[model samples]
Target chain A: MAVFKPATSNLLHIEVINAIINAIVSGELKPGDHIIEQHIAQEMQISRAPVREAIRELAAQDIIQFIPRKGAYVAPLDPRNIEGIYLLRSYLEGLAARLAAPRLTETDLNEMYLLNYQMGEASLKNNVDTFINLDLQFHDFICQHCEHSQLKKMIDGVQLQTKLFMNMSKWHLAAHSELHREMNAHEPILEALRARNQEEAEMKMREHIVMAGNRLLEYLVDNKSSKNSKKEDTETVKN
Target chain B: MAVFKPATSNLLHIEVINAIINAIVSGELKPGDHIIEQHIAQEMQISRAPVREAIRELAAQDIIQFIPRKGAYVAPLDPRNIEGIYLLRSYLEGLAARLAAPRLTETDLNEMYLLNYQMGEASLKNNVDTFINLDLQFHDFICQHCEHSQLKKMIDGVQLQTKLFMNMSKWHLAAHSELHREMNAHEPILEALRARNQEEAEMKMREHIVMAGNRLLEYLVDNKSSKNSKKEDTETVKN
Candidate 1:
């Protein structure tokens, strides 16, 4: 686990949980790796109880799995699970876009526009992280105006899951190059919302999610291929 | 907690988790009740560790909240959370219904029809539990035919959260009476899907979810009133 010792007097479990989640999301903890509580506690200089609590918490979110007698392991990202999450996200987000269209204030539109511009700047400067952050901000800005708290939470939960995939795919040059196209896609969506055309907004949002999902899947396939190749090379060298 | 003999050796944590969940769902463990791990373990004739593990699992799902020093407590069903879940479910299930409609085989249709019929029968017999089970079966059947694993998982998760509200509402007679209407609502959805009319299928499914959400909210309001009145009566007697 990535060691960053910080003061943790309150909510020790939550703090530890976030650290482990960040480690997993940042690729410091690979899938199927055993998460020994003692190791984590020692690294963080905390008791094993809090670390154990954090592991259990992660397991509940399906981010990890605990086998009795065996230890806790990072949950593997199953493509099927990704597909399921994206599919639901697309439909819910499409609804959010539709609901937000008629109700989107001028301020909401302006905020989205500003975010989109910043995203473009980030893309031009080849700042993938900034571009990604802005991209998330733009979508979130629209969701903020949706007036449906339930929809927003559901979308946010799925978005968190997708973020892991997004981080993994960030290493791909083509993925970074698609930032401009992504920004363009948001323009039509914002325009539709500004025009109070719910159908158009919903359609655009669905298309955006579908396109993103497809791209992420492609990146995953490529990543898997490279990983397999590397493994084969190691085996051949050993032989 | 419902007493279960310790015949089953494995799945200890799951069993404990299910027992506690059942208490919450059954209203035996009311919201705000501090979950005593020792008390629960003694009731279920299990060790404290499994109970603690179960509590952690529940906390992760937001079914309960864990307090340091103070024990875990059943999470109160927040109306906002319910609304958010319903909104997301509406969109996702709408998509599933639309997708499943055209792809639904004769077997799928027959299965759904049977489930619906069984739901009606259970409702007529005033077997709310049986009716609810059939109702879930009907929806799950639709999701299975939808052929989207991601959609199914999302739907299932949303349904799980809604179960608490659904159980509370089950106490009301009108909620029980609406079973037939709910079954009828599925007819047009199935018809639209069978006819390969995706738009109609989607519309019907969305309508179904919206109506269910509305009904559940109304039921929750009534449940709250009844609970308040009962407390008032007790206070009056004490005075």
Candidate 2:
């Protein structure tokens, strides 16, 4: 057995946390799946201590749930949770846009414009992952001009929560198309920001967030319905 | 070395986390104050494992910062962070009002009314702690009624980050008066919810959050200036 070591770096825990987060987001670690610390530790060639630390960290963020004497499990995406997250996202993104409006440099506008171009290219090439990445980057770029770390962190946390859902629907061409539409939506926001119209920027950002939420909800509902049908078919065949 | 006892209960970690969180919120553990795992473990009479787990958990939530090779410390509040948090809170609270407007029950209204009454009592008694607690409870009541768990969680997280700053200005009776005004401000929200007027409810909630942010900012500025003056006086005496 490997000897335990006092944690010299939070880096190990963070790395493990990120790995698990990515696994969940990528659907490799599905909701309700048990996470055995020993197994993970062995796989990663580390002590169970760091693995345990990572699991607890993720649990605190509601990304995972731990049951006493049982084990840690990935958290399921509850629709109610999604609704709450989206509501906050809309508000924060709106604020970010408003702040960026007055402070957006020419370089900021150019970067946004460039991001939109890259998004179009990704969409044409049918690269959903690239599209999603660019889309998030574009939003982050806009938020960067806001000069508000707390708002950015809040927004980042909410966005991270939504990433798994977003990734789950990545295979859908319609989702890609919706993302393209979202990219186009940024034009009005960019214009408003460039004009230093805080109200307009905020309004546009709110609308964008609302639209994004609706799109995701639509995808999730459809995905659930299809899943239910598949389960029903399996049950009928058993009968 | 204590042999690790399998966690008897998940509540232990949660309880420890809450204790640490309370300590931070009450200013018993100020920003940047190092958290010694062994010290807390000894005080709580738990093993180092659980304490470490609690620290990791809080660190994940960004309520605490863990530096590699250093140790865990209460996360410091930055003005920019505060600004971002308020922006997000305003939007989330606004959305909560909009959602709650359509679904609010009579019982919800009654609970809020009772809380408002208690807030008034607390303010009258000049109990800052009681008044602040009631103020938070009042807002939380609305959030709960809205039935958006994700939004509620996000809002609660932001609120936790700023609670220290809010408490710092207990000397400002105007802040207490503002809380009274805020309690009354809920009247419009209650009316809008009772009437199922989504727009009105959203408007009222947004205004209340904005006003609250403004009041907090004013208090922080005053506190900062006072501190600055004290520092300047100390420097002059030394010179």
Candidate with maximal DockQ: 2
DockQ of each: 0.52, 0.55
lDDT of each: 0.74, 0.73
Listed per prediction, chain B TM-scores read: 0.78, 0.82
- Highest-scoring model, TM-score: 2
TM-score of chain A of each: 0.82, 0.81
For model 1, residues A109-192, the per-residue Cα lDDT tens digits are 888888878877877777788878888888787778888755665566667677777787776844457666665667788888
Model 2 lDDT tens row, B26-126: 65666767788877776666788878878876776677888877999888776546665676677778888888877877887888888878877776767
Q: RMSD, model 1, all Cα superposed?
A: 4.8
lDDT of 2 at B80: 49
Question: What's the C-alpha lDDT at position A22 in model 2?
Answer: 71
TM-score of 1: 0.80
Q: Which stretches of candidate 2 lie over 4 Å from their true place?
A: A1-10, A66-69, A78-84, A174-183, A223-225, A229-239, B1-10, B79-81, B174-183, B228-239
